[model samples]
Target: MKTIFTAIFIILLLSACTKTLDIKLRSTEPKIVIQGNVTNSGGPYYIRINKTVDFDANNEYPPVVNATVSVLDSNTRRVDYYKYTGVNGYYISNNLFGQVGHTYKLTVTVDGETYTASSTMPNFVGINQLDFVQTKILNKTRILPQVTFTDPAYEKNYYVFSLAVNNVTYKAFYAVDDRLTDGNEMVQQLYMDSSYIQKRDFVTVILSSVDKNVYNYFNVLQANSGASPTTPSNPPSNISNGAYGYFGAEAVSMVSQSF
Candidate 1:
C-alpha cells in the first residue's frame, strides 16, 4: 500500500550529502531553489522555495517568499495555484490529486523571472519484502538492506530509494534501474560506508517510481559521489530558466524492518 513518506522535504534532504564541499564558495547571486512534487496520495501537495547559502556559511536555508507558483495536470487540463504560507518557503496546492500515467507541469515566478519543468507519475511498484545481509570489508562488518520487487517487463522503470535508521535519515540518495533484470524478481542491496547500519536499529525504506529526469538527477549524484569535495560537480537541474532544483512526480511504496 502507498504510505508514510513526506514530499518536498525528502527531495531536499535526499541531497543532504552534497552540502559537504570542503572549499569555501565565492559570493555570487543566490539562485532560486525549488523542491516540488506531485504524488498519488491526493490533496494539498507542497512545494518549497529556498536560496542556497555560501559554502562556509551556516546550514540554514532562507525562504524565498511571495513567489507565484502553479501546477498543471495534463489529464484534467486544470491548474492548481499555490499560496505561500510565509514560512519555510512552502507553498500549498489547492485541489490537485496525483494520478498514475498523467503528466504534470510546474511553473514558478520569482522576482519577475519564471522557471518551468515537467514530470510524469509512473505506475506504482510495491516492495515484495525487505531483507538484510552482512558483508565484511577492510576488516569491518557492514549491514546492507536488501529490497525485493518484481519489475514489469512491458516497460522501462526507474526508481529511487530513501533510507532511514531509527528515525534518523541517511545522507545519500539511492537510485536503481531495471535495465538488466527486467521482468524478474530483483533483490537489490543498498551499500553505504562501513558500519553505517547497526544491530537492532529500525530501518525504513521508501521505494519511489520516478520519471527519467529524476532518475538521471540522482544517478549523476551517485556516480560523482567519490569526487573531491573541493571540486564538487552536480548534475544540471531538471528545472529550466536558471533555477536550481527539481519538479517531480513520484509513485511510492515503503516498508520498515528491524536490523
Candidate 2:
C-alpha cells in the first residue's frame, strides 16, 4: 500500500510539473506579390498586385491600389499603360498584345518603390493531336488526355499547359522543358488530382511557350506546392524589388475537343 501511494504521488507530481509550450511565431514584414502574364493569343492582359499577409491570417490578400503599372516593348519602344479595374488586384492593359521574338518589360511603382521584370515572348508551337485514353493511376482507372507535339530541332523550348473542363478552367503547374526530348515528337499526358473529367465533357488545352526564367519559376512553384507552409524557403520570383510571383510573356496556342 505504501509503494502504490508513492507511485501515485510521483505520477501526480510529474503531471503537475508538465507545462504547455506556447510557441510564438514571429511574423515577417509584408511584401508585394505580382502575377502578370502576356500572351500572343490576345490583348487585355492583366497584372495583379497584392501584399502578402501573416501566416495565421486569412487567405485574402489585400490589393495594392493606386500604383503605376506599365509594359514596355523593347523592340518597338512602345509603352502600354495599365489601368486599375477596381476588381481584386487586377490592372488591365489598354492596347498592348504580346508578340513573338519581342521582349517585354513590366514596371510597377507603389509607395515610392518600383519593381521590374522582363520576359521575351517565345515562338509558337502547335499541338499536332489530342486524344483520351484509359490509364491506371494510383490503383484507379482514369481517362487521361494526352497531347502530341513536335519540338523544334536545335532550339531550347519551354512549355506551360492548362486545361479547361466544361468551361471551368483548372490551372495546374504542368510546365515542361524539351531538354531531353529536343527535336523529337513527344506525346505528353495531362493529369489532375480531382479526376473531374468525364466522357463527353468539353475540354480545352492551352499550350504556352515560355521563357527560361518563367520556366524556372513554374518549376520551383510546382515543387513547393505540396510542401508545408512552415517551410522557410519560397519559390523563385522574376520580379525584383523584394516582390513575389512572376511576370511572363508567352506565345500561346489552344485546342478544344469533346471527350
Candidate 3:
C-alpha cells in the first residue's frame, strides 16, 4: 500500500511539471543613450550618442546624428562647442581639456529635445607600485596583477581601474571606495575572466580618481555584467532628461608592466 501511494505521488508531480504558461511581453518606447567622459589626461574628448532599440530587435543602436553638443566650464563660464564627427554619433571638442578640480557641464540638443549632465574632476592620485602574484582558483593557477597606493587622509575617495592586455583593452570593470581603507595603505588585486596571460604578455593598468556618482555607476554596471537582459535592470545614469549611461570627469594615472 505504501509503495502504491509513493507511485501515485510521483505521477502527480510529473503531471504538474508538464504544464506550460505563455508569457506575453509588452514593448515600450525607446530612449536616448549617452556615454561621455572627460579625463585629466588630455584634450579632444568625444561623446557618443545613440537611441535604444526594441527588446527583440538586433543589438544595433541607431546613432543620433546632427545633435548639437557643448561643454561648459562652470567656474569660468566658458562654453566650448563640439562638432559631429559624422561617424557613429560621436562629437569631438577641440579646445576643451579636462582640468583637475574643475566642474564640467555637458549640454546636448537632439531633435528638439535637450539633455544635460555635470561632473567634477577629482584630485589626481598615482599608483605607488604594481606587481603580479600567482594564485590557485578552481584547481587552476592564475597570475593576477596587484596595485598598491596610499589613500589620502580626511577625505572620501572613489577609484576605477582598467586593465589592458597585449595592447587590447579588456572590458572588465573594477571600482572601489575608500570607506574602509581611508587614510591607510591599500593593496588591491586585479583580475580578468581568462587565465591565459603569459609572462610575455604586455599589461597596462589605469587608475582613475572618480567622483561618487561615477563610482556608483561602475559599481552597478559590474554587478550586472553577466546577468540576463530580462533579469537585470539598467545601470543608473547621471544624465538628466530621461537618458541612459554616465558622464564622467576623472583624473587618470596609469602604469604598465610586462608579465
Candidate 4:
C-alpha cells in the first residue's frame, strides 16, 4: 500500500509540471526586427524586415518574408509600394526616386506587426554667402558664412545640420555649432565656432535641413512672418494665409551665424 501511494504522488506531480510548462509557452509573443538603407542615386530604395532577436540566441534575427512596404514623398503626392521578392524577407521599389527637396514616409508590415518611419530629404541648403572673420581662438580659424533660405516653413519644428570637407563628402560631420537663431530679434551674429580650422578653400558649411513649423513658430512669435519688412521669402513662409501650409512639407534655411 505504501509503494502504491508514493507512485501515485509522483505521477500527479509530473502531470502538474507539464501543464505549467504549456501555459508559459502559450503566453509569449513574437518579436520583429527592421533594417533600412538609402542610396545616393536619384531613385530606388529598399527595406528589409525579420524576426526580433533574443539575448540568449546566437543569431537572433530571423528573416521575415512576404511583408508589405510603402514609401511616401514630402508633398504627400508620390507614394510607392514594393512587392516582396519571396526570398525569406526582402522588398524593393524599382521606380522610386529620392529627391533632395522631398521628404519620405515608410511603412512595414509583417506577421501582424507594423512599423513606420518618416524623414525629409536633406536638401543642400545653398551657401548664400560666407566669409572668414578674425577670432580669438588661437589655434583655430573661423569661417563666417551668412546663410539664407528660399524655402517656406511648416508646423512641428525640427532641424538637422551637418558639415563636410568639400572634396570627400563621405566623411561629412554634423556642424556642432550649426543652428538657426531667433528670427524675431536682430541678432548680433550667427556662425559656427569650432576647434577645427576650416580651410576656406577646402571646407564648406552646410545646413542639411530644418523644421518649417519651428521656423514659422520663431517668426510668428517675433511678428516677422512677412515679405514686406524683410524680403519676400522671410519668416512665416510656412504659413499660407494664416493656416499651416502643406500638411507636412515645411522648409527653413539655417543662417551660418545661427549655428
RMSD of 1: 5.1
lDDT of 4: 0.39
Give all candidates' CA lDDT scores: 0.76, 0.75, 0.75, 0.39
The TM-score of predicted model 3 comes to 0.86
**115-138 in candidate 3: lDDT tens per residue?**
999999898888999888888888
Question: For all candidates, what are the clash counts?
Answer: 0, 1, 1, 13
In order of appearance, the predictions have TM-scores of 0.84, 0.86, 0.86, 0.38
Q: lDDT: which is higher, 1 or 4?
A: 1
RMSD of each: 5.1, 17.1, 16.5, 21.1
**Candidate 3, position 19, lDDT:** 9
Ranking by TM-score: 2, 3, 1, 4
User: Where does candidate 3 stray beyond 4 Å?
Assistant: 1-27
Preferred candidate (TM-score higher): 1 or 2? 2
Q: Residue 240 deviation, candidate 4, in Å?
A: 30
